[model samples]
Target: MTLSEQIPSDARIAVVTGASSGIGEATARQLATQGYHVVVGARRVDRLEKLASEIGGTALQLDVTDEDSVAAFTAVVPRVSVLINNAGGAKGLAPVIDADLDDWRWMWETNVLGTLRVTKALLPKLIESGDALVVTITSVAAFEAYDNGSGYTSAKHAQAVLHRTLRGELLGQPVRLTEIAPGAVETEFSLVRFDGDESKADAVYRGITPLVAKDIAEVVGFVASRPSHVNLDQIIIKPRDQAGPGRFSRK
Candidate 1:
């Protein structure tokens, strides 16, 4: 279905974070195409400007980990119908015993704390919209803990539970919370996780066709377009080659 057709008349303004690239980028474009007034945010001002121009959406400089930045970012939107929290990532894949404290903190700050910062800042706007939606891009790691992914796993799992707790808090409110968990998707995710190691990132999907960013973006569109009474609480999507967390069948 088309965006205009999918969007409820009461909810048309959609805000997407981490929109410089990957699933965030794709979702921003998709929402705009679907007729929502899309507001895209990220640290890369130039890239966001380009994307905003391309999609006819507003672009803002936002650092989810920074309170001041998030405050400034949300302050501009008079009203919002959807908030996509895609501004999280993994740092390194070190085992628990070999983990670096700093790495763990960065992961927690970016994944868990970052989501909290943005949500807290924007919840008021969303609640004001009458029938708003909040969707987050989590990971398959949220459910399965792997050997070398202690920090990332913990952060994701924390975020997953965080949303569940939020649902209870907003029970009577007209806000819907959705979490989109993806498995083995090919994007800058691995590059960032491995600290810009090109070969290591490429090796991640060498044998298997992974889910691209647009795949998740499409899901976001569907969730955003649904009726006000329907809440798609969580969607766990993975490539056919991926069985579970760290379980991939490469060709």
Candidate 2:
């Protein structure tokens, strides 16, 4: 049967990490619109509260890097049929030679280990739900690397591989795993990468109609709304003006 048919009218539980802004915020809102009781988790409780109130979902203060936060967040969310792993980002853009080891460590800790922590803590609840779905938001850097992209790229690669392994391991289970790799999405990602340099972030998408948070959100919704038998393993989304990593057209 179709996904809509499979999802009952009664509240279906959905847990979305990094739901304070960008794609995470959009996903939480979209899921709630789809009749799911979404639990939005992030470090920014104020933003999360605003979003939750607007979307009619619950907001929980969760820092994915903290074990206690992960455990507490999952504990509060009684049931979760869908898990969106979207809490990850990089801080620096430097070549390996000049790159700071601390930056790399931070990226891996948050992008890779953080995801693992949240997933593992919530897996039992997901499995018990019998129709669980896990959607991980990775990046194009996972497959293609450019100068100064090592730290972020490596972390994304780890996340992608984790999803791949999970997909294989959960073959027969009711849960399904998916990885989405988005390229050049115009969001706070670049701003965070550039340390709040608005101009630099804007330059990244200057001449191109890059993907927006809503774009990724729509894709997440589509994947989640598919039939239970159909699993979209990996999706690579990019703006038409951008060919691949570090290749964007200037008009």
Q: After best superposition, candidate 1 residue 42: deviation in angstroms? A: 0.7
Candidate closest to the true structure, highest lDDT: 1
Give per-model TM-scores.
Answer: 0.95, 0.95
List candidate 1 stretches off by more than 4 Å: 1-11
lDDT of 2 by residue, 1-251 (tens): 53234445467889899999999999998898888888889999999999988987788899998898888788767778999999999888898889889888888988899999999988888888889999999999989888889999989999888878998788888998889999988878989999999998888898788998999999999999998889999999999998888898978
- Please give the TM-score that candidate 1 achieves against the real structure: 0.95
- Model 2, global lDDT: 0.88
Q: How many backbone clashes are present in model 2?
A: 0
Model 2 ranges off by over 4 Å? 1-9
Please list the C-alpha lDDT of all candidates, in the order they appear.
Answer: 0.90, 0.88
* True lDDT of residue 198, candidate 2: 93
